[model samples]
Target: MSAAALVVVKCGGNPAVDADAICADVADLVRAGRSVLLVHGGSGAIADLADRLGVPHRTLVAPDGVTSRYTDPATMEVVTLALAGGVKPRLVAGLSRLGVPAVGLTGLDGGMLRARRKSAVRAVVNGRTTLVRDNLSGRLGRVRTALPQTLLCRGFVPVVSPPAIDEHDQPVNVDADRVAAALAAALGASQLVLLTGASGVLADPADEGSLLRTYEVPATGAPGRFAGGGMALKLVAAREALTGGVGSVRIADGRVSEPVRRALNGAGTVVRLSDMIPSLKGA
Candidate 1:
């Protein structure tokens, strides 16, 4: 498969998502001669492990209303253990069972993902803006595509996840959606599909029928005004992929059969850079 045929699929960490179905779909795509790179999130698994280990799992709500995991030292440890030890192995095994050679990798592996740690962040806590200084989360800085490209060339599906290595050469939690976007851009993939629990980017979160076929993220403001919770971050990731030169970005439901194929065929919300306001394109 050529670079234009490469597809980056991100599997959501929500427990409702069917990982088995996704792996099966990936097998079909590979058999049909499409190159695929899988990136997965493990928030549910991390929370579960944190519970069992007696660690407090918390979330930080940005002023714009986007909520993200508050990855302090303890939570960061949980994130690493859950994704690397549990979630990744399960995905690799599922693919192997379906006859797809899958290699599980973390962002720290071979510096596949490098990030700059955000030593502090401003978040809204109980209606008060607080400066969070100890959160061990990082913003993605670079994606090294050689490792994944080599695997894809050898007919192996590379399954990747987060805990990106920061400038200090330490692991820090990073959002998986952003990871998918960065990889898609670096690989020059034709499509970046983010499969989540929701049907798509719904105009109303309570109604699945209200799925927006296309959402134009504003060039200069927080997309959270249009979407709350995880959807907000998905929109942000979509914008990044589009601006970074990925052909297209889609937010689709991961619970159904053939989720990836459906998204590629336009079953979900599509985001394109052309949709942004022309005057604010570079803002």
Candidate 2:
């Protein structure tokens, strides 16, 4: 199958999102001869396991106000276990039940997803800006596409997750949305669909009726003040996908039926590089 026919879907880890529906949709797509790759996050599962294991779960707010899970050594272990041991298996099994040949993989497998470990992350902690040195997170550096491509060629749907390997061969937490973006770009996928709990990107985060049909991200800075919480990160990932050669990117509601198909059929906020600020076109 041509890479241009490939579609990468990232399923949000929100408990309210329907994973089974997404799996069924993926199975339908596969049967229709469209190459699909599924990426997922397990934040909810991570928190649950952390609670069961008596690990204190914490979050870090960057100076810019973007919040992320604080992955200390303990939290990193929980993340790895929750994603690989919990989430990936269920997704692969669900796909198989739907008659789709599926394979589960982590970024640590085949060195497929590589990153540079962050020694410290600057964040606002306890109302004071500080450098958090114990963070075990990383920023993606490279994606080895051969593994996924080979699997896709063999007709297996690659269900992938994080805990990407870093420079020293250590597992480090990485954002799952960015992982989808990297894979979509690396695979030259025609579309990247990010399914969340809400109805696309809303002008008013609280109002679903305020859903924007299209959102234009600023070329040089953060999306906008309205882009808060996970939406901000999703926008960043969408921009990266568009910039990295994805044909289009959509942020849609994962709660709806046939979410992937809906997004592909224009049911979410469509983001494109051409919609960026004119002055900062190449920035």
For model 2, give the 10-residue run with minimal summed lDDT.
274-283
Query: In model 1, what are the clashing residue pairs, if there are any?
Result: none
What's the lDDT of the predicted structure labeled candidate 2? 0.90
Please give each candidate's TM-score: 0.95, 0.95
lDDT of 2 by residue, 76-168 (tens): 999999999999999999999999999999999999999999989988877899999988999998999999999999999999999899999
Task: Please identify model 1 stretches exceeding 4 Å from their true place.
Answer: 274-283
lDDT of 1 by residue, 240-268 (tens): 88888898899999999889888988888
Name the 10 consecutive residues with the lowest summed lDDT in model 1.
274-283
Q: Model-by-model lDDT, in order? A: 0.89, 0.90
Shift in Å, residue 200, candidate 1: 0.4
